[model samples]
Target: MAETAVAAVLAELAALEDPKVRAVNEKQGNDHGVNLTKLRALAKQLKTQPELARELWATGESAARLLSTLICRPKAFERDELDAMLRQARTPKVHDWLLTNVVKKNPHAEELRLAWLADADPVVASAGWALTADRVAKKPEGLDLPGLLDVIEAEMKHAPDRLQWEMNSCLAQMGITHPEHRARALAIGERLEVLKDYPTPPNCTSPYAPVWINEMVRRQAAE
Candidate 1:
């Protein structure tokens, strides 16, 4: 019965697959692509079905795994299971989704963040940094903002692409949320010069830390 239900979900996912999106996903290093809207709709239908989610995740298809991230119960994941999933994340999209939908909500989020931040795997470190970024964006009351800025200043230039991106995100969040750190964050941004040359689309915010900090500060002032 469980197998049948899992097959039905997979069949729905397959039916919703878009070749164009799949091609783009492939270029972006994802192994599969289904319409994300459709996938989310299916996940909504299967909400809280951790057993079914496990089955979908076990199939190892990218879309199914993406759906599983939504349907799986955060509390159902053991640290080891989450660790294994982080280790096996093969693409940035999957890793990002897992961090946002699964790991961030999990009971083990703090533990995982601390452990994975020191992990040798770039993907794991990326997820850890992402989790830290999320925390910085929200309840950053007790976090060592100065120490964080120090680390970003020291390591961001030599970090891997994924880790660098998350570090930049964390830096931006810190600058936006903590007024005392704003000048220091901008200074660090200026010093690191990461993504300084990356192009921004018209009317879009630049990702360079100083520019990003300025834009966010502007928005905050307006609000």
Candidate 2:
């Protein structure tokens, strides 16, 4: 019964074109919206039927995105599942989740996530930096610390002023906290010197930035 439903849902989702899925994905609410509801239902279905997740993942990027969200949420994904999900994920959404969670879970994800540095899309490239910050916190060896710095620095060169400011904030967290690597992060800041006179960083008004900065600083210092 569950398998039938999973197949139908996947089939329906598979019929969606990339442009259509990208359009809907762009509108994804920060709070998950209806997608969260479907994610929960599928999670339950997958519990008794783990194969459903594989089926959903095999469908396409849309299903992969949906699965990545569910796989990151509580009471659903465990360490091993996260491992597997990152191991197989190939979509941008999956890349985002992998960037967001994998480093904290395992050091091996760095190599995979760093490859996104060359991705043509800035969003994916930014996500790669975000993942670099994640792995840097763990102080994992053999990871591309300098390469990550290069990407962030390069991003400030032609990136929009708004994104440049965001990189500044990431710099503060990555540089100020990781003393050993603080110089690398500061190099990124130097590359974004255009931001120094902006009064406040472009997007610092958001409530989340200060809190995130504070926490990241604290964690980096602790590391």
Best by lDDT: 1
Worst 10 residues of 2 by lDDT: 28-37
Residue 100 lDDT in candidate 2 = 54
Write one digit per residue (lDDT tens) for candidate 1, span 36-148: 88888888887788888888888888888899899888888999999998887778777888888888888999999999889898767888888888899897767787888
> Roughly what TM-score does model 2 have, to 2 decimal places?
0.51
Worst 10 residues of 1 by lDDT: 139-148
Off by over 4 Å in 2: 1-3, 7-38, 41-45, 48-50, 61-64, 68-95, 101-108, 120-124, 143-151, 160-172, 180-223
Candidate 1: lDDT over CA atoms?
Answer: 0.86
Best by TM-score: 1
Shift in Å, residue 126, candidate 2: 3.7
* Residue pairs in clash, model 1: none
Clashes of 2: 0
* lDDT (10s digit) by residue, model 2, range 48-119: 443555555565554545653444332345545554554455444555555454344554445545554455
